[model samples]
Target chain A: MTAAQGFRHGLRTAIVSVFALVLVGTYVSVGALAHDFGFSASWVAAQTVLIWAAPAQVIMITAMGAGASPLEVAIAVGLSAVRLMPMVVALLPILRTPRTRGWQLVITAHFTAASMWIEALRLAPDVPREARIGFANGLGVAFMSVAVASAVGGYFLAFSLPTALVAALLFLTPSSFLIGAIRNSRRMVDWLALAFGLALAPVLALGAVRLDLLWTGLVGGTAAYLVQRLRGGR
Target chain B: MSVLGDLWPYVVLVLVGFLPNEIWRWLGVVAAHRAGEQSEFLTWARAVATAVLAGVVAKIIFFAPGALASVPLAVRLAATVVAVIAYLLIRRSIFAGVLCGSIALVLGGLVLAP
Candidate 1:
């Protein structure tokens, strides 16, 4: 394929992911939660505008309502966002074109996350570096729009919905994450992280003061890293 | 909502979320300059990111709490597996995985989720 064609193909793939997963699935999940929980519509809207991350936003809203300590909530919310660091790192080779210097990247970095990052990552090999950020930003803009609209509207809808249905919709928040996580695993570290995080949640819940799911991430992420290094760095 | 009341908190929240994001972005750029090539740090980042994604997904599908929290573990798990297979069949397209799994969940609820 011509370079232009390759860029278009990569852009198309990224856009598809933005619409299906980021816009449709993640927004639907968050909208469901917004309708059931007292999460501020404006705050969640701002998060999408800025964070564009689904899992961390969801956890932050729920944890706040639970009256969980600020530290606990921050750690859980912050730890889940650890995924962002690696996500950005993985996309480095792809996004470094034009040497996208200083302020421009800082402006755009807010746009990176699982769906966009993952799409850029898988298809970057074929795309020219110059086009990667544009394509990614395009995808990010689409996801951000859906989330802000969904969150604001869903917050208003919650005032009218029956308790039972609101309950089911709320369930979709985590369900979206669960499905996405299962689909994203490509390496041994992924498998271990999934296993360790899942196992850690219930075990932590057993404690007098839950070990906080956030730590599970630090522990699981660290353990996976160590094990991967030991296994000949495969 | 007075500017000083409900809206103010949100203004602060937006500023807070925005700060870290920018810091990371700058850090990404600075770090990128130093590490033009993929290094162990990047590898570690990828591994941790993958694990986090996996964990988050597993928690939602198999272990989420709610009114439907009573849904049996096996059924929830089976639905996720169906989604995974669908994703694989589609050559790892997450769009296919999420939609397929959501459908599988509804169908499962219709059929076996008593």
Candidate 2:
């Protein structure tokens, strides 16, 4: 590549690093979580690669930690993922391009989680429609590679890391996540999502049953949307 | 071959867990073509995703094990809000906010530890 091409490539990578940090960090945390919970390494890697959502992953593992049955954990995790359908609908339009192959689309789609899609939506307007998908894939690829690497590392290193530090790192992704949400929320709906989820999580945590993550997403998300609508958020 | 035999069940279990997520991604590819910025579905997705992230944040902050748990809840919460707000204040830089937040979390833990 030419100097300019190289520089742009580097710049794109640099921008992705901002996002990839948490993604990779989350991988490490999840690795530790899975290992601590006695999950198989391959299972952890597959879900992190495929699922790409930490909360749902955490919920599944945590439920297991709480001795929930495999069927129960599966149901809880599946319910947590119901929200992704909307994310998929909202995000892919920006990335859809004629030249973009279906397989490529499938590969890149692995990276389309909530945070990535939300940011891409803001940037999609400035991008040509056809190239949007390419850009999204390019963005998504960085995280995929990182997740793969961190999973490998975390799976191996899970036994070495101290308990306290692992917990700290696990806590870090969400802190970084909240920071991302508060900063990136351009619309009123965005604000409501941030505040409502933040407020309702602890209450949901107190639930004796499983599915706290899903319940929080449902009740808190609806309330936030309602509150936003009441304030004329549309 | 032996290693493969040992790990086969895990491989399948992993497959089952990820299949649903892959469906979501393929669906994203289709939506990339059909949806628009102002689409109501987009708004709903954004709200749900953001809320989930927030809930995730709440869980990590309050419930995680180890040194972070040793810190006063008030201090940790305050530090998170301050760090995240500072991230926005610094022109929406994720790097800036996260770096500061991580620093604050570690430092706060050290100071608050008994």
Candidate 3:
């Protein structure tokens, strides 16, 4: 197929991907719940447009709700976003060509959340290089538009929904991520990292220390990496 | 209303929160220009990122704040296990896993509620 057709195909696949829809919907609920937690609706909307990463958005909202100072909230959100670095690193090459413009890369990079990254990594290779960015942008635009609308919808719904349903909505975000991580687990290191992180996160949180997520990630991740290296790679 | 008082903190959070995340994406663009995907640093970074993500997920499941805190630990754990099992059984379909896990959590809550 031609590059234009490939772009259209990628865009269509992304819009129809059930996993993408679920993740986007979960993010919308998260944004709405953040508003419910007392953050201004405008603030949540800005976060959706600007940060555009659901995990970081959730961390920021929860930290703010827990009375963390703005600096603390920022720190936690930043730490939560650390994981996206490798994702971006892994995805940029797949989406870029020798002639791809810098601005195009920048824009697409901004849209590279886990959902997009996973899709792009899987699908971009088959698409013509010239059209990869367009495909990604199409997916990004569609997902973000729906996600923003959902956030607004959830914001209105939050005021009317029962507490139990609201709580379940909140649970959807993390549970989805947990399942995503499990689904993404392919290598021995992936499993080890998850196990180590799962074991360490609660301990750190209960310790009442600052930057608990950051520390848990650093220690758990480093240990997993070392173990994998010691086990002689892969 | 004191607009500054109401807004400045969030503005600060946005700026600070955005930088750390964006910096990585920017770096990724640069690195993708220079290094092959198989570079050791990228591999290590991927491992670290995966672990960090897992840690965050763990925090949410085990030490969830607010309403989720009310659910029993056993229920949450059970739901997660079932979700993973469902994902595996369904050929790693994320939607199925999430749906199964969510239903499990709700059912677990109903059954285990006291």
Q: What is the DockQ of each candidate?
A: 0.41, 0.55, 0.54
Misplaced by over 4 Å in model 2 are A1-16, A34-44, A56-70, A97-108, A162-164, A207-210, A227-233, B1-4, B20-35, B65-67
Q: What tens-digit string does per-residue lDDT give for candidate 1 at A1-234?
A: 443454456456644552433454446556657556665666677766766777667776677667776667656665556556556665665566655666656545677766666555655655566666666666566656656777676666645655334434444444445545655566776667667777765555455334344566667777877887799655
Best by DockQ: 2
lDDT by residue (tens digit), candidate 2, A1-234:
332343344337535656677766667767777888877787777767667776678777788778876677666666767667656665665556556577766655676775566556656556556556556665665566677678767877866876446545655677766766776677787887788888788777876547676677777777777777788857
lDDT tens digits by residue: candidate 3, B5-99: 88885666557667766777787677667655566666666666666767777887888655666678898888888877887899888778877
Ordered from best to worst TM-score, the candidate numbers read 3, 2, 1
Q: Which residues of candidate 1, in runs, are more than 4 Å off? A: A1-12, A35-43, A63-76, A157-234, B15-33, B67-70, B90-93, B112-114
DockQ of 2: 0.55
Best candidate per lDDT, number? 3
Q: Model 2 TM-score?
A: 0.80
After superposition, which runs of candidate 3 have C-alpha atoms over 4 Å from their true positions?
A: A1-7, A37-43, A58-76, A125-130, B1-21, B31-33
The CAPRI quality class of candidate 3 comes to medium
Worst 10 residues of 3 chain A by lDDT: A161-170
Indicate the docking level reached by candidate 1: acceptable
